[model samples]
Target chain A: MGPPWWQAKFRGCGYRITIAREVILNTLAKTEDHLSAEDIYNHIHTKHPNIGLTTIYRTLDVLTNLGLVYRFDFGDKRARYELAEGPKGAHHHHHLVCTGCNRVVDYTDFIDAEVRLLQEIEQVLSKKYGFKITNHLIQFYGLCSRCQADG
Target chain B: MGPPWWQAKFRGCGYRITIAREVILNTLAKTEDHLSAEDIYNHIHTKHPNIGLTTIYRTLDVLTNLGLVYRFDFGDKRARYELAEGPKGAHHHHHLVCTGCNRVVDYTDFIDAEVRLLQEIEQVLSKKYGFKITNHLIQFYGLCSRCQADG
Candidate 1:
């Protein structure tokens, strides 16, 4: 892992690998939960008090634009983010968001049927609508086990 | 029909079916494409100039909260609104948004495999994570035929 793919991606896009950007990327890469900018700022504040919330927001915007991070809206008005390619490997996945608890589960256990269906749908839509299909975002919203149990 | 499902829903929730709300709902109900608050206001403004932008925004908020409308962010900063149950029958669908031209296509042609996979996944996720799944949002982002041809 020569400086990680994201660093290379930053360089490829002519973006500087500033400390703020690097820290933000590392934080998202290491954490499993979806985090808001304010949450991220809190996570980095004690260790990097100089890293302003504004910088985190701007860096997130840049990273999201570069496809290095994914911004999610779970109908909570606030945006949450997670790394596109995380420590969990290169396996692409969707999300199961707990609307009750704000917990997010990455659903990576893609069955053959699911994969085939997606590929087929892409082909069908592309042919039907003449779209050069690129990618997709899918999220299921509900109550997590703990939240249900609590209720 | 005595009243539309959404109108009943609003009444059930004790929200008055005011003209502003009714006009906003009618506008979204008739239009096929997604509209921002401004777009919706502009559309209604010509005929109903008395309906202010603030009222449009408020009604949209109310309608969205009532699950009568869906709010979408297509990677653009602007939010788009569409009826949850549109004039195209009760068929549930996803969206295919053009990254270039901001065109949105509703995909309702679900194959058996697609439907089965979703059902199976919901079951699996519910069992595996103890998530009582309620709903889902899925959108595919891509370039339309014209955009491809233009390039």
Candidate 2:
């Protein structure tokens, strides 16, 4: 319908849009779940044979640094990435990951209270430990019904 | 003084206590915060040179599997480990990490309402997605006062 969600984000963040960047962004845009860098790289490589794994890594890093994407780990060896530009635009959210099938479902309903608590904890830790807190991630791991059924 | 907290846990769980396991457990026990595998390896190596990195990996896996330790990612490249045998034990507590120095502070106090809400979210996700929810991890990140002062 309209320009894809990530395109608008790249524009808003003043990120230069290139074919490779577009491909990567589009890949993440279509995914409702988290994708490993390798997953994104393999998918893009099929359509754009010239795209290097390094390019995928670089693009992902740039997007993460720009706060247009979120990075996560679910006890898997590799890290995963997801578009941070939500349906509402520039929103923050957490995830519930089904350990059975590795599906990630986003939840933004509790963000305000979550953020407030996070800030309070950060304050307490800073005062108590002399440690600097930068960013954080919260993930819930469990089984989806399909997996639960099998189990 | 007395046996470190984890020593009791190993005995309580009926896990075989090995030399390397004790070193790993005690290393984590002596710390007041989280430590990466390499951190534990380095500290243990000074006293136990024959302790292979592979053993550290193996020991960590065993500890995690037995619920003797907890594993988490603090946006760090390496996985961090902490003793799970705390005042709140494994499942009931969350984490506070200082982004400044990579210190992890345990927070056992939790609002019951928040816990209930999380369980509700878990149930909803389980039903809607066919996923089974096992456990969750929540960490708050910010600058500790020492880092704030240094900055």
Candidate 3:
């Protein structure tokens, strides 16, 4: 309906949409799964072998700074990213990361009770600690089904 | 109470208790705040100048493996550690990290609703994804009072 997200996000900014950056953004947009820089690089490399890994990493940082992407650590050593311009509710979903097999499941099924609980928690934290809450991250660590079966 | 946590943690295991390991554990036990590897090294370096940074790193790996310590990343690009032997509820508490000044508030005022939410999420995830749930981490990122004031 309106302007596409990438344009809207950087219209005011001087960030020129390079081919590499465009490929990275498009790759993330199409994926429903969280991906590390290496993962993105590998995917982009298949289509655009000329795109360097460093370019992907740099573009990812720019996207994260521009708020077009979300970067998080799932207790995994590497940082993972997802497109923040996706569907509204999709951006706030939490993660279920399997510690054994390193499987990540994006869980967005926030019940009414959970929403109320988060609101209460944010209220309490903001009042008690004088923090102006902006964002939150939650991840559950465990074993995936295949790993559980193996274990 | 029962042979001390460090001793019990390595009781049956072939891990011998070294002076360096004890210092590492004792240092973690003393601090309620998360300490990075460099932070821990600095604290112990003053008292035990002989203890090398490599020793601290190795000891941290051992402690983390034994579940005697907790390791997490606060999007700060450094791994942070905290003692796992804190109060029952203390271990399960979440973190409120200030993006402005990087202050971390360890919030433990969890009610039954939060626990229930987690259980529900875990059950649903485990059922749908065949995950064997074990643990979880939650953190809220925002501006602290000082940062809010500065802004």
Give me the candidate number with maximum DockQ. Answer: 3
Which segments of candidate 1 are over 4 A away from where they belong? Answer: A86-91, A145-151, B1-6, B86-90, B148-151
Can you write out model 3's per-residue Cα lDDT over B1-151, one digit (the tens) per residue? Answer: 5555558658678899888998988888877879999999999998899999898889899888888788877767788998875444245667899987788998877645677788888888778777788887778888999998897
* Pick by TM-score: 1 or 2, better one: 1
Compare candidates 2 and 3 on TM-score and give the better one: 3
lDDT of model 1 at position A42: 94
Candidate with better DockQ, 1 vs 3: 3
Best by TM-score: 3
Worst 10 residues of 2 chain B by lDDT: B108-117
- Each model's DockQ score: 0.73, 0.58, 0.77
lDDT of 2 at A118: 66
Per-residue lDDT of candidate 2, residues A49-124 (tens digit):
9998899999999988777787778656788987876676445778887776676778776677667776776666
Per-residue lDDT of model 1, residues A14-114, tens digit only? 88989999899888887878899999999999999999999999999999889888888876778898888755544677889898878788887664566
Error of 1 at A103 (Å): 2.6
Model 2 chain A poorest ten-residue lDDT run: A124-133
- Residue range A1-151, candidate 3, lDDT tens digits: 7755567667678878678888898898888878999999888887899999889889988998887888988766788998885555255667888887687887777655566788889999999988999877778888887887786
